[model samples]
Target: MLSYSRVILSLFAAVLLAASCSDPTGAIIPDDHSLGWGLALADAVRDSEFPAGVLFMVSCIDVNDEGDPETAIPWQFYYAEVSDSTNVLIVMVQYIGTTNHIWEDSTSIPLGALPDYADAGPWVTAARDSLGSAYSDWEEYALVVKGNEYPEFPVVLNVAVLQFMSPDTTEQLSVILDSDNDNVLGIIQY
Candidate 1:
């Protein structure tokens, strides 16, 4: 003996529940493109805010090269790893808006080509060759964190920022941070 309003409310609840169950996060974010190279042992120890054995990999993707000031968009990609003796938790910061953010695991993305570590000279030369003078500012960093860092639990944060593009779109990059411990090693463990 339910009223008309009660029946309608029940149906609405069931529909909402079904939708959430299908895709818990509401919308799915696209996978990032991985960089073939990971954190070097030397660089890890040098740059890591974490403990002795954390590894990190990072790269920028789908970059827009327009230099005009009026229609530029800026974005950053970040990776954070939290580990202990028993478990490891890794989070990928794909895109962050003014209030909300999206993140996933490190493995979900596919790998890109490896950067040449042996000779840093050639890599810079190649980037310059491709980019030319159309860019007002183009700087590349090696094993640096552009965002926040927490030394406790030996947390490791690796970040890259892509700035100034023609159409306003978010930028993405792949980064891995691992505790040098064998168990927590990322895809491209050093």
Candidate 2:
């Protein structure tokens, strides 16, 4: 009983509904490489209108990609006001459905000392390559960028590749790198 135009409109509406139901937020494809890291950091700093001088540490955790060391992941930038070191500001950037979502919060406990603000792409690549075939066994990756708190090393890049053996047991490989020259300081397995 419906006209041709009405039938066509109804079918179109049905198709749209199906698509919306399938992917409500569209695809969540991450960026090509760790390029998102710099982009997100810049976006967060610009949008938040916060002074970059206070930034102390940058980190990303819970990364799951096994093959690509440069895979994009959410990054967190930590800043501490010079006068008020007791409270630290956290700027978190997450990519969702082709756009980035940036949010900020404050914490009482900071991660570490100041950051060297070095590019993490090269460090990640070197770390993964050093792992060789063992890289496949790690299900998660995490990296922290901060000044060396120890007197022994001037490390600024701390990358951890981990594989969970059981609920309480895990195997971890730690890659330490210097920010001054991007040199691999050490690789320890535990």
Report, for every candidate in turn, its global Cα lDDT versus the true structure. 0.30, 0.54
Which candidate leads the pack in TM-score? 2
Per-prediction TM-score, please? 0.22, 0.57
lDDT of 1 by residue, 11-108 (tens): 99998887865545554432221121112322333234334323233333333222111112122222334232222122222332111123344433
Instruction: State each model's C-alpha RMSD to the native.
Output: 16.0, 5.9
The reply for model 2, stretches above 4 Å from the true place, is 1-49, 64-73, 97-119, 132-139, 154-169
Model 2: pairs clashing at backbone N, Cα or C within 3 Å: none
